[model samples]
Target chain A: MAETAHAASREHFGSTSRRDSWWLAPGLVAAGLLLLGGYATWAALQGTHFEFGRYLSPLYSPKIAAPWWPLSPALLILIPPLLFRSTCYYYRKAYYRAFFLDPVACAVGELNRGKYTGETGFPFVLQNLHRFAFYLAFLWLFFLWHDVWDAFWFDGRFGVGLGTLVILASTGTLTLYTFSCHSFRHLVGGKLDCFSCTAAARGRHGAWLGVSALNEHHMGFAWISLVSVCFADFYVRLLSMGVFHDVRLL
Target chain B: MPEAVLHVYRGDASGGGLKEYRVPLEEGMVVLDAIHHIQGHQAPDLAVRWNCKAAKCGSCSAEVNGKPKLLCKTRMDALPPGQPVVVQPLKAFPIVKDLVTDVQWNYEVNKRIPPFTPKPNAEWRWKQEDVDRVQEFRKCIECFLCQDVCHVLRSHGRTDAFAGPRFLVRVAGLEMHPMDALNRTKFLKEDAGIGLCNITKCCTEVCPEDITITDNAIIPLKERVVDDHYDPVRMLVRLVTGKKKGE
Candidate 1:
């Protein structure tokens, strides 16, 4: 109250709630996503669609395989948003409004203010596991790009060639933009001052600055990432199902 | 064509109930207009704080029914009229009268954060990209809606621990810039309690300027905290190399 306009204590101003209900409209949407994911998984197993069988094959290697992989655990984007809510005034209010109140209207999980419920984990806690998830997603993306590469060109069989480089570049740029995020960067020790002074650190910072510049408009990336991930999954699914083609241009 | 019910929280900290006031409806009118009409006609002593009614200054933030919004920009017509429109003070800060809460918590938090520290070793020229990193935070209007609604500040009152989202963004602007030499990671982890934030993302939802407060600021700060405190390997590597990050 010393710095505030009102005489009210911090206690006087409190959030209604911010936990979103993963039911009703949001739940239905999530269910649809689950169904699509399930179908994609199934299609990959069957090898009827894109390579119905090969996509499910453990023998196949993705574009960015484990050996020289650039993808790390820091790529998770959810952590920042989650961490932000814990410290934000608006998020506290919205958190309660969305999840605690009508729960059904909310698309995500709930919170107990500062409590990190370990046993019956809430959606808010999913942010912590983001680093690992991002690693898997990034790995998959690299593989998909590799698959696109294998599918391109004239000496062409079922695989590709030169034009396939474009897919690799597109995915690479998207991953760079996503991974270079303030959130992901933070996850990877980006806020570390030493990195700025080190050899590749400065240049990486330069690359980060380039990406972060694009990232500063993160709400843009948030939307585009959402769209890209969905589109990428759709492409994979279509190819898996044989319902669509990769259209090799060599 | 219809009348709207204004559900006002009546009473001081002593205790208050919601008082209902009926207002005539019109097109293109904002919630602020109705509050003003009610104040002028029925309750002259009704306490509310606002300025720059154009929504440029973030003074008039309040819960419209339940959402955090600048009353000036919230069109009454956009809200669902079937239920009572509940207008309440911002939740994170203390209430002065009605819709106004003490926003000074923000200014104080801002003070605790490290100021922009430019490295003294070299020329001051900066990349336009570096400048862009922190500039997004400048769009903040100090509505404190983000501060008022934050659970750490509101529910826990950990003012001594956390700096809240508003200050986090303020700090991010200064800390992330390539031109800034002052390492704020220590302050972020220790003084500011960056690890305390759980990334619930409630701030991103209510930001009027649409700044991704959680994704852009808190996450990065948390990452910094992890590098400083949780990640042992990175620390050893940095120590061996004689380079300290967020120092």
Candidate 2:
């Protein structure tokens, strides 16, 4: 074989022979993650202004009514959903490249060289908790949907408001994100060695195909849900702060 | 007659650079056709590896204008007009000559992966969905465009540690096989270095077969690895039930 380690081919950080604008993707991802992440952190810090007459911020959904807890209510309920997003297979790829600059784009040089440990070591090994987080996120969806249900009940009567739509969008996207999770897909169809071996396996095979189709768009759902969750919170916050009246669409 | 300028790389591991040639353009001429024109009319010694011009054989893999692509699939007219079309060897491998790199490393990686081993007295039956699931991975042509685009091999030069997306797809086919009994998760975790793939998905982007390499193969394989190596809950369940890992 011709020599494997050709010295000229090894590129330094952010360097490559690639001619296209390679930085555009990782740059945009970083900016978006930071912006949204910042907003989530800020919103979580404020315990007040998270609820509007009938609607509740998704960030504070299934609202923890424990007055004994000293911090923002959002902080207590946000951990599992936060862990879900953090350890997500798609987000790991996105943030690893975008935030860590671990080859910010494919074939692009990165800050770390041969010293890479990937997810095999400390801290990153925690990423394996993704499935556990997936379960939590899946269960968390019920509370969000309940909040959406609440958003429709105004003045003890059923009525649709813009806040209802906003909360619904948040819950809907979160549901898509949860159902389309890589771990969920694997649990549904991927674990089986023989789909034809059993009737249940055959059923799982069908479910797997559906989840596989959804998994293809998991990254899109991840981004859209991120934005939708924040937007829902912001909308509710505005209403609760009396900055705007809830526009009834009933 | 309209002609296109081609800057084909010409040299070996010691070093080399792109050599320009002009070829007459045809209605549907591909990059491989232009290279053939250069070989026949201009430079007979201009070495290039190609088996089938149909793009299915995958022997015509190279970087065209800094993009990993099959030369047979990339049409001449599809590229930017009036600019030199550059063809070079795959960056991840060692150069043997002009536009031909040592892809032997890929074959070596393939040999390391255990092939499908069926269970004892296992039923041969499997559903269409199982076929459909593994079939996507079976479509890989071994072009190594995925390997060429993979940063672990191309940039990090961690061929010692990482098995690129191509083999991951290969393993996915075997691992997901209905009757296969082999537990290759140990090989995946320790040797294949499945952890190294961050899954930015350029392999999926450059694939001519349109294989969902990242989403279908790598991620699922990684999830399996998690089941074996990382999931303490699964481990505890196995312990409580007195069941083996794969069972």
Candidate 3:
């Protein structure tokens, strides 16, 4: 055991202190979000797009010329503050803790263990519900596709080329982010035995690199998760209506 | 501040009785301080094991009002207001004297698991992120609140089947760590009995550091175990490709 302990110390070089040139990840994300939001907003007023029924566009079939009429932009005003607070976690770790784990500030449904009945029925019953939540989260992977579909335009930007791909990248990233979550992994129910299983390729392939990356920006994920969904939905709505163009070359 | 009547369980394995005494309760007095007051002023023979008053040392653990907590951090005000505070020795470990219990068994349980074994020739400079992953686990003072509250060993008396939460957290911290490449999951399941934790989340509730034990540590490790052994497609891939997952 002593020999093995010494050996374990030698292999992985696991150092997780917060100080190893750590400013780069958040710094880059902050600059990128700023650039994206700034460009999108500036293009909104200058561009002839501010169509109200944009989300309702594709289903409108054989797309007609967009009506220039503006919807009540009151909801749009709330977007910036919400977006800023949400994406701020992407840039700062402390913000995540203050927002999510705060005793008073946390989401209402932590399923306090204090409520357990110790019976075979209730506690385990509630635990089984997580798998359903997993399915709900799994639907997000496709919702990004839905957002991509909604944002697609045959007439805009040489007939909708990279929008799907961009949304795919966003969705892939979001999937990586969500699957790395401790709760979702448990719901997938893989921890019943040895680590060398056959069907767990997705989980095992993703666990190490994914866990380490998310662990680094856990605070960011905690906050940005709430923000990204809102932003993605907004991006879809804004672009579909031609109110804003996510005009950028990646 | 009102004086508190501390009813200390003042016996050993031979079985003794509760001895009650009053101590002056200050605004920020911990249960340990009250114990100390009783020891110094009233019962010098009162036996209690303590070193660092800070919660880091893990030595001053006693069942405060029947809940396992590090004595130094438990504030007197947090106690139920009207009842006399009841203190007892740790129930799982055999009583050494009054408030101290023999925690040597925990160390023995720790020893049975093979130590950390990294991957081959894996000498690399430790990454800061990797260190951060294990840092919170490092925060464990080993107060054994998780162990004490663990129903497997405590209530159900599954001493032979379960390794309890404290050790599981220790093993998970070491195993999930990026730097430590040792595959200790087999040891955890067979010897440590990781399956006994039904995700009741009782251990997480008692942890003073607020570490997400059930969700973060235990459940994820459990998922990994399931994937490794139970996932048939992974095994077929490993068989066909002649590759191995981290062991």
Candidate 4:
């Protein structure tokens, strides 16, 4: 057996560090997620500035209760998006490496805790909620569209404004994000065995391909939609606080 | 004659670095062919493991230009001309010599998994659709590239905990088999450490067989783990009946 000689020949390269700037990507992801989480938390807690003349913050859209509902309006509507992002296949990797340091990057050494309990345990296991949360997120899109419809009406008259455009852009990007989800792709037709056996199955296959195309850009959509949601909320909040003027485009 | 600079990694476990060799390039030469030329003429002692010289055997797996690929499949033309094609052993495994790494750990992990267990005296009948997903996983050639790219094993050194993407695909095939009656959810949750994978899809990206490791296999297996361990309704049912769903 060459095992003995091979065992003797084993060599270790000291800490496989890349020459290029590998830390920059994960560092950016960490900063971005942190900024988004902090901003969303602060905005959600305030409960005010989520609405203006016609615009509603993406964070508190489909305002389910009265202003005196006691609970933060953001909390009421945060469940769907929170579950979507938390259980997101892509975001899971991002945070797992960025925050958990589960081998920070490819080939880079990670925290040697000797034992690892994956998502099967407590809070991490909650990530399984993503599939269920996907249903909620799919349903929440309608409310965002409804808000977009309301955005066009200023003072009850049909007119376009800066808030309308912002809300529209936000909804558009979120639509891309929703459709591009890995879960959504699997749900569409990833489980099918025969794509050409039936007429409806063929159509489903086509839809799956379409979703697969978008899934290729799932990461890009994730970041863009995240930024767009924050911008949408900030736009509505600033307008509500009289910090920014709503330019009439009609 | 057109030539390419091959910066092949040369050294044993104690220490090593890249040793450059200029090989005369042919019209259809691959990186493996260049290595063979170097082994034949220049460095007779240069060590590289290969068999079949085709993409199927999975023996010539290495990192070409810092990407995990089968050496026989990566053509010289595919890489940019006038640049040194850096070839190295897989970073995830321990280097034995030159481009050969000790991939025995993967075989060890494979042994821990329970083999396919079919029901006794059960009629063996399944529609093509039923086994189609499992068939996708059956295409694995044990290349270990998935294990190489996996951060849980390659980066985090969680070989003890995580089974990497390759075994997860194997478990997926067993668990999803319509005729197989064994429930590996417990093993998946605890022993294999399925939760450690955050579904980066890097394994899928690097897979030459086009197996959808993350979406089709790993994610669905993760769901089974969650249903068995975490679901409140399932937990309550298990408490009341003293029996699991698979039972």
Candidate 5:
């Protein structure tokens, strides 16, 4: 037998060849998530600047009624979107790879810590909550649209401002992200065996195709929506904090 | 004949690198044909594993230009003309030689799966609708391309815990089988680590068999696991009635 050098023996915790900076993506994701999470936590705890003249920060949408509750209202308001994001199919991959260093990237080595327990255990198993979260997330969209509707009316008169446009863009992108959910896609038409059978099924199949098209760019939606939400909150916070004046376009 | 540059990985277990070979491409040459040319003309000691020149046997699985594909099916014309097509072994498993990795782990995992068991003296008749769904899973040629592409195995090296998408499809075939009696839910949840799959659908994309792996096989199976293990009402019913929910 000829002495052949096997590539598997060169296996290590990461890639060998000196490629362009591979860590940049996961690094950015980690930093972005951290900034978002940290800001949300602080903003939630403050719980005061969530509402400005006509626009309510998404972090405090549906304005939890229980003011006397021990925790921040942001906690309650955040539940739907948080669960949605935490259980999001794309977000799970993003955070898992970015935060947990779960193999980091394709063809890259990962931390080999014996048999992988997967999501069978305590914390990881909670990811199954994503489907239930999808329900809450779907319902939450109504609240956001209502917020957008409220954004149009400044003190009961129909008008559009920079805040209105900002909120509109935020909700629009977030709607795209929410509709493009893997679970939502499945609910739309993924479970159907036949698309041509019956008018309703056909309609659903068409809807599914539309959602699937959006689902293709789900990762892009996830990131953009995240930024949009943060920006909306920041804009509202600026208005609320009196740091920046709301530019009236009407 | 047009010439194409092939950057084939030449070394083994200790260490190796990409060794370029120039091969004259025929009118309708596939990647495996070019590798054969390299073996015959330039490097007689070249180690390459192949079975059917047709795409049936699944033995010609390799990474062609950073994508998992069957060499016999990958047409040279489909690849870019200027760049050297990089051919390497599957990234998930241990490499035994050049292009072949030790895929025996998949076979072992197969052994652990309980064979299809029918209810005692039950009618063998099955609805075509049921057969149709399971038939999609049966279409798998066991190329292990799905396995190679799955990030859980390919990137994470979680072979011990997570059975890659290939076995999940196998499990889906058995679980969805109309006549099969035994429930594989426990095995799927605990042993196979079905929960690990976030359903990215990467496996479905790489499937030459065109199996909708994520939607059909993995998601449905994940739902089963949730129903069996996670549902509060189902848990209470199982505790009180002492009967499995789906059965």
Candidate 6:
């Protein structure tokens, strides 16, 4: 590791005077994100078991089919959500600290990359497109909600099942995640300087307040939504493979 | 009365080590109270700075039990019952004597930021919502606890570039103000080094005032910075429409 000198005699990477379990947070965050990401990637690659009788994997929602596009349908649908998540404000913090080891944990030593530009240039600068991705993610939410609605159709009859509940949980958590986005919060309410000046502004202020409330727990929603989406796909995959029987709930 | 062991750091910038002092704990007492007991009885010159013994003054910022906290606010009972509570100077700044470090660096950084400049022909008729938004940032008592907890300053020693979380909160207050006009995005990008922050939320965790430093303050400011400097689409729109940024 490259060395950066300090007035107090700086130490090497990962060095810290902290006595607490400082490494636990970043370690778990890295492992969790990697594990979830790995599962999603693997599931996306396997196009065969993405659908059951009524339920469709969230990874392959809106089931795209074209003669030219022979690849997994999941590949087409996952990009927007992946971009939205990869650029998310909360996820950026998690992955940056966990994967980049940028100061590892607070007050803990980090690798000396000499000049750290953060999100101002190159690939990192692409994070600025988060707002654009937010639009796409917001649009995709409609598709996800549609899939949740379709999950109830069994033998051309509307009925609830375990798969319906799983898909519902996925869509619900994802809705929370998308609505609680910082960009969405800014677009809805944060931009307005005077809320009471105009009727529209007042309406936006109410939206901002609601978004702010949800934004407070954006990190929690992010994790839960990630897990739920993966679980939704995993359950549907199992059902499609006839490994796990889907129980009719209604 | 239970006696608590206080492991307080002694000496100055040259070097120092933890000195064990046993203080008699009192009912509803704080870590600052224990330090005061040490001053009153054992060591008369145990240098520790404090004011408004309430958590409001932002004084007496130190690392208690390996966490950056206000000594005046840390309850004695809140710490682990048996273990010695270690009190160290804010490791980010240059040590002055004991627990007092040269926090003047923060004040210097405070000077570099442009003050709130009201917009030209501005009507100061903002609603309570605007007030509530900026009011969260105004709650900062200049504690420097957020500064101490920030790893860019604390560990990486990027005081030369990064302006830490405290000043970022300051910038957020000014930038978010409806009537305010001055654009500091260039300054935020260059001198203040807003990009260096990875948004760990450590500053938010350690803040006694509970200001949402990362999510509310820093991230919004980062978005503004992105608008002016990084985003191509926004830049193209500005270029074509001849619209000023943040309009």
- Return the top candidate by TM-score: 2
Q: How well does model 2 score by local distance difference test?
A: 0.86
Please provide the root mean square deviation of candidate 5 (C-alpha atoms, Å): 5.4
Q: Per TM-score, what order, best first?
A: 2, 6, 4, 5, 1, 3
The RMSD of every model to the true structure, in order and in angstroms, is 7.9, 2.1, 14.4, 5.0, 5.4, 2.7
Instruction: Give each model's whole-structure lDDT.
Output: 0.58, 0.86, 0.55, 0.81, 0.79, 0.87
Give the per-residue lDDT digits (tens) of candidate 1, residues A154-246.
353555432244344445545644564454555444554434455576666666556556655544444344344334445555566667555
Q: What is the TM-score of chain B alone in each candidate?
A: 0.92, 0.97, 0.92, 0.96, 0.96, 0.98
DockQ per candidate, 2 decimals: 0.25, 0.51, 0.05, 0.24, 0.18, 0.44
* TM values, all candidates: 0.67, 0.95, 0.56, 0.79, 0.77, 0.94
Question: Judged by DockQ, which candidate is best?
Answer: 2
Supply candidate 6's per-residue lDDT for A49: 88
* Per-residue lDDT of candidate 6, residues A102-168 (tens digit): 7578767778776667765688877878998999999998989999889889889999999999999
lDDT of 5 at A114: 62
lDDT of 1 at B80: 72
lDDT of 2 at B235: 88
- Candidate 4 lDDT, A1-250, residue by residue in tens: 0111122122232245343455787799999999988998999999788999778999998888667668787887897898898888889988986887664665555665654556656888788767677778889999999999999997779999988999999999989989988767766765454455578867887897889789878888888988999999999999898997999999
Q: Which stretches of candidate 4 lie over 4 Å from their true place?
A: A1-24, A31-48, A62-80, A99-101, A111-125, A129-146, A152-165, A168-221, A241-250, B13-17, B77-83, B118-128, B237-243
Off by over 4 Å in 3: A1-250, B245-247
